[model samples]
Target chain A: MFEATQLNRRNETTQKLFRLALGGMTGILILPVILILGTLIWKGAPVISFEFLFTGPTKGMTAGGIFPALLGTILLVLVALLASVPLGVAAAIYLSEYAPNNWFTRAINLAIINLAGVPSIVHALFGVGAFVIFFKFGTSILAASLTLAIMTLPVVIVATRESLQAVPEAFREACWNMGATRWQTIRRVVLPNAVTGILTGVILEVSRTAGETAPIMFTGAAFFLPLLPQSVFDQTMALSLHLFVVSTQVPNMPEQLPYGVALVLISLVLLMNSLSIALRMYLRGKKKW
Target chain B: MTAMAPIPGRSTERSLAIRTSKLNLWYGTFQALFDVDLDIRQGIITSMIGPSGCGKSTFLRSVNRINERLGYVRTTGTIDVMGQNIMDPEVELVQVRKQIGMVFQRPNPLPISIRDNVLFGHRIHNAGKRDARSEEDGIVENALQTVLLWDKVKDKLDKKATALSLEEQQKLCIARLLPVKPGVLLMDEPCSALDPKGTEAVEELIWELRGEYTILIVTHNMAQARRASEECIFMLMGKVVEHDDTGQMFVTPKHKETADYIEGRYG
Candidate 1:
């Protein structure tokens, strides 16, 4: 009975065929990533130098380093994180811990999903209308970062809520039974456990913020800036926008220059993603429950 | 059993730790408790035994106002803890919870160190006050010893509480509640997650805890009820069938349903 019959043999063949198909599909998914990174490094490695990374773009964006753009991206990502992380985490805590299960909270949840679904171009338009024009910030880093923060708020909130919910109800019950207030329970028990997850979400937001070119295009990012931004109110060049300008908008731009900018931008995002994954693994290892 | 820090407001005037009258509860439209009237004595173990969905656990949770955590749950009638109606709007939930501690079916230790778990409730109750490390250590050792867990876990106080075995975790859960000096303890099948040996250990700990704290435990294990409790309560279909001395109830049940349940006719 244990011996393979004709039917069993056929079934095994079909299973093997399906496995191959699925593995091929996964390989197909990874193909573009490998190709893009390989091409960027292969073409861009020659252009990379100490001066090429730290100096401002020269000769009308055809040459020189991307220091201004690099600094601007960092500033934008940091400011966006500052604005979004606190607001998102607090909103998540309220929804998860305090909000009564009612239509009002359901509506708020629905609004968040819809907000996340809104197009980046629409967010760019909104940034122009609200932060830049209406709020009188006027095409500055503050305006762009706010737009990015709003766009990524849903991500942070959802991640935080999920992590908070992942903490077993038993822990909260244990706290509440001890006469610990909800705030006390959250601060002592809930938030500490959820921090690494929250950090992962924040890192995801950082990577996304660094790559996005549309939202900051009209709101803050300039095609070329002679000086790096000194404050949130200043317009600045970003890596993503610089890559775009060099690749399509600027004339006589070296082939490797755009590739180099793209390589740097991709590297930054990947590094952030790696950091987040590492952090999550570290924290998860430390946590027992 | 060493001298515990005196919990303020532990009045010895009243013999009854918890008194409930005409207690009715509902999960949305489905009523789970029907006129549950009980007077659990102070410093004794009272075990409620019943088939599933019989409102025994509901009654236990109601004592601590924990059932209200479910948004759809609706309860009526009064539950008095230390002579105060906990359901009264003027009564703060924190105060109600402070007066009563609960252990769940599964051991739920905070994902924190053993030392931290032992000190969690104490710190919360004593907000903005810092206890000396030695003093805190004393409290930890005392609580753990009371639960019969100190010797097993004494040296690893800084280790994660969740890393302990299920039995130790349950004991830790119980130990954490002690420093707050709750007037009553409610347990909902606290050993249901444990193996046979673990169940016996926790049951013995509960037995040992009697006369020091009033503990109301809900159990499906008939033998556990008989062995651990001083008084016994039997309920079926959301109504109490009998409440009597543990030995007397098991030997000769007052009601047919109680007898039928005790004999394991159907649970």
Candidate 2:
């Protein structure tokens, strides 16, 4: 009986040790994120003002504001989403819902994986070759947005496929048994259920597209634009590229300007991620079966 | 138990509701069913009893072409439902599904409200044809009432169907199919996930639906088969070993294998 009690005590101690190890690891992982956000807010909070957000930059991008850049980033994200969401979702539906288990499907899956792994700089070069030069869209917002869209297509496809597959197969079967066609099953039951996951993917893509400087740099973003882009064909200043320029290329730039840009970019991403998370929670609450 | 008379509205012509001729199925290289020939009559409850992996569920799925969803599955032979050969190249899947409804081992209602769930199939089948708001309300009421779920859910038709107990969810699954007006219902171990009370409640509801729809139920429960089905089919090793009236099959099975299974000597 004494030995049994001793063994139980040993098990409890080991369990507590395991829990502590896991908690410690979590804290270690989150430390960098907290430090980064804390540093950005401390350095950049005073520079963020309403006029700074809504006016064009002045004095060689050293003083005035980043409104054109901010608007350009939003436009870039919107156009990329418009280009990729429909195509990516359609491809995902084909892969998850209709693709036969054959070598062809396997090849498509491999292509998607490889496309995702390709570097952002390589995608920018491809955009220049294909969209800017070949298609004559020129070094413009359309070309840059197309490059970003292609780069992010795999993310959307992967997420959409996972969520579509996550929908219980039984739901499809039930709908089909009631004489609903395959498309109808997807439209009425599968898509509605998977919408939350799909939206999360799109939102994540928004943050990713917003912060990417490499793909948009050579393809569309200008070092400094006096006025905002008026059309898809126009080159525009973007927040990420603007931060890069002000921090590295410009001489004697205000110290807080780059920090403020970084702060806004990160905050926009965080806000979108939070919205996706909230939507997921709401949808999960509504899900039955 | 005494023999129950055939329910009213049953086809007096004694026609077959479902007919399978030399039906065989395989999942890739693994054969799950072999030469399953069955002629299920219209408007009666027929139960299929077998041990696990005996191809009872496989047979039911084949009738509705649900097995084709698997990429490697291959089926040969013909399935005729309501005089139309479903295996024919020209027969649309939508039409076949409209004629047959299915309930699963577990209830699977959409994440939508209960009323929407009931009207889902009807809306799909009648796409582009607008129904008056009141007519839709009536359709929803009639289907739920037939499943005997209207009273419990009437006050909150807008509530999500998943919030209900398992038994109610199962009933809602059945109610949802009714609005589509399927002539046959395929039940694959419908009560396997339910408690005894839920099973009894669902079984009673199935009995209530007897006169209007033909039902083919696959169950592991021999007692359920004997009590609920008017006719019974016993299968072993993916082959039908016996098909007879429920009373006859339970009292005096013709084959030794059937007798052993009924007498609890073997699965």
lDDT of 1: 0.89
Highest TM-score: give the candidate number. 1
lDDT of 1 by residue, B151-216 (tens): 999999999998999999999999999997887889999999999999999999998887778899
Q: After superposition, how far is residue A213 of candidate 2 from its true place, in Å?
A: 0.9
Q: Model 2 misses residue B108 by how many Å?
A: 1.6
Worst 10 residues of 1 chain A by lDDT: A197-206
Off by over 4 Å in 2: A1-26, A275-288, B1-8, B128-130
- Candidate 1 residue pairs that clash: A52-A65
Proportion of native contacts found in each model?
Answer: 0.93, 0.89
Q: Model 1: per-residue lDDT, tens digit, A50-93?
A: 89889998888787899999889888988999999999999999
Quote the B-chain TM-score, candidate 2.
0.94
Model 1 spans > 4 angstroms off: A1-3, B1-14
Ignoring the other chain, what TM-score does chain B have in each prediction? 0.94, 0.94
